[model samples]
Target: MASNVHSLSARRTAGKSAAMMPPSPPPENLELDGLDRLLGAIYEGPMESPPWQNASQLLRERLGAAHVTLMLRPPSQDGSGAMINTGPTQQQHVDSYESHFFAADPFVRLPEGEVFSAEELIGPQWLQSQYYREFLQPVGVRHLLGADIYTREGIECRLRVTRGPEALPFDAGDKSLLRRVLPHFKRAIQLHARLDFLECERALFAGTVNRMLLGMISFDQNGQLLETNQEARRILAERDGIWLSGNNLCIDSSQESRDFQRMLRQALSGGTHPRAGSEPELVEAIAVSRPSGRAKLGILVRAIPLGPWSESKQRPAVAVFLRDPEANAAQPSQELVRRLFGLTRMEAQLALLLTEGLTLDEAAEKMNVRRNTARTHLRSIFCKTGVTRQTMLVRLLLNSVLSLG
Candidate 1:
């Protein structure tokens, strides 16, 4: 959501004589132009930020009010509400209102969504009360006009125009303009809330994907990187078999890169082209050679679903998944392997090492186990896991759910 842009400070006057006179009638076209600008600003971002500030300033200038405030009322006694005021507001007045006076203000009691003047709510006798004399008087508030706007989030948003004691009272003309602009203000705020919701959902999905062992990257039709989550960032930073070239994902081998490019293009094109007698199968994975010649970086390119109702109209059209067997193996999932396949902790550790491209002799040396002991674990692993070859065992370990965490 767009955040609030600016705040106001109330100005303290030595004497009422120092205050500026009310602005003369503004040109009608100028007011209309301001409304048009306000509407455009609404589509830019959430109204909590620049739009609210801009609206207040424009309304203040047009209505010739001493100040303008548009904010949400506190929904709960303990909750702070949204506030955007047009000023150079006085800190003293601001503090006083925030501390206590706001709750006592008679304006909140007015009927919702109706424009009313200060006199309509409080008469001369009511104005004699301490809330007015002590709080309103010191703040230089005299006459005012405002209306309430309903938000989609069920918050009561209020807009108020205030005048100084020396200024003319808010008249029908001022209220008329506010009434005209109120609908646009409400719609803009609702639009902001909707956009904010969609943004939150996207973040939640990305977070879940990031927690997986795979590194995920989203790219557009031109292969421009669009988004990469936390795990993807860590993998890309390694600059191993697969790395980013400028903003594009690149593979170490040229042939592999060509294959990847064709696969991505085919997927995005909906696999329309026929190969021999039938449409080619979608390529699911590609292997990139590592500099260490150990475990290669395994990349899986998948197409984002495309349709009229699909969410990818503006988002990325393709996503790439990267798996670093060596990196994921380094994490202590040995206990997980032990429990899943009935292997001892030692045997699990040996299996993890083999997934890192360690030969039988190398793994035996690293684990400080004799050749016979290592071979014994290997035979037991094959029988229990139902995979006879080392290569098959390595693939099984990588594919296992235990490797994800």
Candidate 2:
């Protein structure tokens, strides 16, 4: 009876040991349909929304893991200087770790395509290192699974999954799962970076347009206004050229209006004027004429090539300029200041004399005004604006009015 009882106990012990052993081959073929479904969800909307926060939650549910994190190494700094936590925790931990352990981290230094097991991460030798004890263990992380996201711009983003102490070490199944979903993560990272770049480019373009002096008006090939810079809007509004009819630009003066329309028609036709050879001649023609008191206003027409690959080879454009003797006649006012500031008759006359190196007395004499009266007008002009002296005033005026034209 004693022998039989001992035999039964030994058999039961053997059965428990066998059950406790890790499953052979680690179930590497576990179902990946759920992972595919998760990836599909991420791609459903604009990549920015349902951002990393949403992604972390979905990954936690699908992978049955305790936490997940995404870290970014900015080009300006070494190691993972910019870390994003997409896990349950609101604050970031990896950034703090990277700052302290950048030089000691084997995973960061390892080349692409290399893989490491969780045992290697938490082993006594590795764990003894300050980084492991101070950063990883305190956070309840016993195992780590990591992969790299590479970009064409030479940036590397690291994605990591962490498991708790009670959980079994990441098995072959987990590694296989990571391998299958890595491509999706890579796509997400690239998409996110691209969206960020596009936003920055949009802001830069807007800033540049706002800073320009020459009013810029963009039109479709059909002569419909697509967009206008602030300066262009102001000019159009002042000249009564902005029209609500079918979103078209309309000039008030009949002759100038006709010229603008003709120039636009030519531009849209995509026809190039005959040239002598392969080198096309750059030419400007008069498109419109308007009478402003004793002076004539004209729109100068030209053709500019849209791009290196444009089929039209040339795009038609028109620039409006004053043909008034007062505007064209070389005198005291620099051409730019007269056009930009809407200076009064006296102000323009004063500016021209100053630009030609004339003294206050000399300018006053030329203008047939008393010295005291000229000085008074100059003082009023300086005070209305913030210019304190002549040189500074000249610079300010030039900066406000000048353009690449």
Candidate 3:
């Protein structure tokens, strides 16, 4: 597994003195909100971009440190690990630390989860060693205080809060604040584990019916919702005229609502359509209007045909396909365009706009670039994408499955 350490640094801070003064009091109110934020991080959105980073940042401020980093020590592959740090460290510094310097650093070679002062982890002698001069001195980090936080999946992650040379060493008060917030991190890890499982399941189910640019809703024999794709979820969440009230699917108009329920019931019961003898399975398409007076949602409802002996318990009796005319299309993978076609980021953006039916002038105006620059980007895009005419460029992009965004 490739380690993707997103902008995390391994920065250490100031020297320790035996008679160090106590740090300022921990912010109780902010820490309470920070704990809440950490719990909500797992459920906020994609697990790929959880709010744990933000929570860690909050901890940094609360603990009165220059920067905070959460690092996976002895990386999951049982090697030197990755870091997720908050600070103004360069990517070069991060790469240098993980690839070379981290292995020699004595701070990471300590006991886990127990708060340790830098003095405890590495004595003054080691701090002045060659590793310190070559690495830490240049980075301007003098010392760090750390504690290992446990995840439900048993991933080994340690939190390191750094201070600069001028700043005093982290005191007991800082350690106490970290201890208070530790339980929140422990619970957040469990939530992360559960979300991982759920997201995997959602991907599997959505892949079945929503591979195309369509939203799907699976309903049971009693018109109860069994499941829905992410797109269907967005439509339901909007409550724009059509929404789900309890388990029942509902539309705006009372007359249309009655018709929708009747059609849904018929489809769910596996009964013949009104024109069953001729059409057998006529797809029932409806225009669901929005209460906001926006464009109507186009929904197509149809019955799932199965043999009398079929024993699929999880199968849906009725499926609804929803499409909002105004909904944004799935963005294509800009990475793919850059890698495959060698278009620069700006050129790729212009290419995407061109595909979206935007004229050169319009694309320029939207990009906030002059028309000449836009034309220059367009020319580069044409060369890279292997197309000349705007029509051909649109055709290539429309047919290709590069839009992973």
Candidate 4:
């Protein structure tokens, strides 16, 4: 695994001595509505960009603390980790903790799933420690309440809340409240990690499909378009053979339209049907004729698979993949092409045009160059690409990952 350390330094105010203060009285009774809202925020934390910002704020308010910091990933010497702090502390204070003070602080590695205070964990000796004088005291962090959660997903997260000397120290009531919500908090972190992984995979596959010059369109059970990629939108906007009529997929030819609708219905049925003891759904294909006399658009219709326990929702039931044989294949930038094959600008441009299905004479005319110049560039492209024929050169360029750039 790679390190997550980043330059997270920021500016903050000067520190003050943390006077030994008596523990404050226990807090008021926890309200049912407040608990409900806090639980909701905890689950929603994973979806937040900074993860758990709302939950951290709510927890801070509930505890009446100066700051609430959730160390989703602990800070390291290299200054890499995921930490969220909810407080009015200066950026420098945060920078100090993330960059350097984190290592010296003795509040970490708490008893798993148990909440503890600075006094309970470190005793009276904590006040004389270097961490208190140089780091916590300077920022007015006098009292600390912390809990550690180790999930099955291999995440060791710490929740810490601090109070200034002016405020009362944490009490039994505060620890009780934290203990009550700790289980929910652990589950939320697990849910977030799982979702984060799934989202990354989804983006990777989506980008690969788009780079392949394939148009993907997904439809709901009602035949309404649910989602589409950039290539699909581009193909529909051209309106050569297939396009959208309102929100419905359409073909220029009546016969093809009927065929497409039938296939779409079959695909939808396959997706929603019971999966147990069912035969695999057959993928359907069709060629949509163009009015402009261009090559027919190749379309493949298939069902989006569903798990046995899938719920009823407005989701993609059928998917359509469109391939335009006459359309230009996605090409890398001229500079990229030049670097990949060690070809000059002119040679790279000529190679790109050839990949678009243009003949040497047509490409030369487009580039405002003579046919003989185009031929010379072509010969050079073949030699640089280690191919002997024009078709081989085109095939090589199309098969390469250059288009993914």
Top candidate on lDDT is 4
How many Å off is the CA of 253 in candidate 3? 17
lDDT by residue (1-405, candidate 3, tens digit) is: 123333232111222332375775679866677667654652342254633676666677666677888774444325556566777778898777777876676666445447887777677786777777898778887877877776657666667788889888888888877766666666665666677789888786577445455788888655678987878988889999888888767787988788777778777664543332344664687788898998988888888765556566565777889998887776677777677667888988888888888999999999999999998988878887778899999999877766433
Once fitted onto the true fold, the runs of candidate 2 whose alpha carbons sit more than 4 angstroms away are 1-60, 74-80, 92-106, 114-118, 121-129, 137-140, 150-152, 165-169, 183-209, 215-405
Against the unseen true structure, what C-alpha lDDT does each candidate score?
Answer: 0.74, 0.60, 0.73, 0.86
Candidates sorted on lDDT, descending: 4, 1, 3, 2
lDDT for predicted candidate 2 compared with the true structure: 0.60
List, residue by residue over 1-405, the lDDT tens digit for candidate 4: 123223222111111122345545555333777888899999999889899999999999989989999888898876577889899878777778788888898988888878999889999999999999999888888999999999877999999999999999899999999999999999999998899899999999999888787999988766788898988999999988889888888788999999998888887774444353466655899999999998899999977776677676577777899998876665679999999889999999999998888999999999999999899989888888899999999899987878787
Q: How far is candidate 1 from the true structure (C-alpha RMSD, Å)?
A: 14.0
TM-score of 3: 0.47
Each candidate's number of clashing pairs is 7, 5, 10, 5
Error of 2 at 24 (Å): 31
Model 3 clash pairs are 8-85, 12-143, 13-142, 13-143, 13-163, 14-143, 113-148, 332-403, 333-403, 333-404
Model 3 lowest lDDT segment of ten: 6-15
Which wins on TM-score, candidate 2 or candidate 4?
4
Give me the runs in candidate 1 sitting further than 4 Å from their true place: 1-31, 43-51, 73-75, 90-99, 129-136, 151-153, 270-283, 306-314, 326-405
| Model 3 ranges with Cα > 4 A deviation | 1-50, 72-82, 109-112, 129-131, 208-215, 218-405
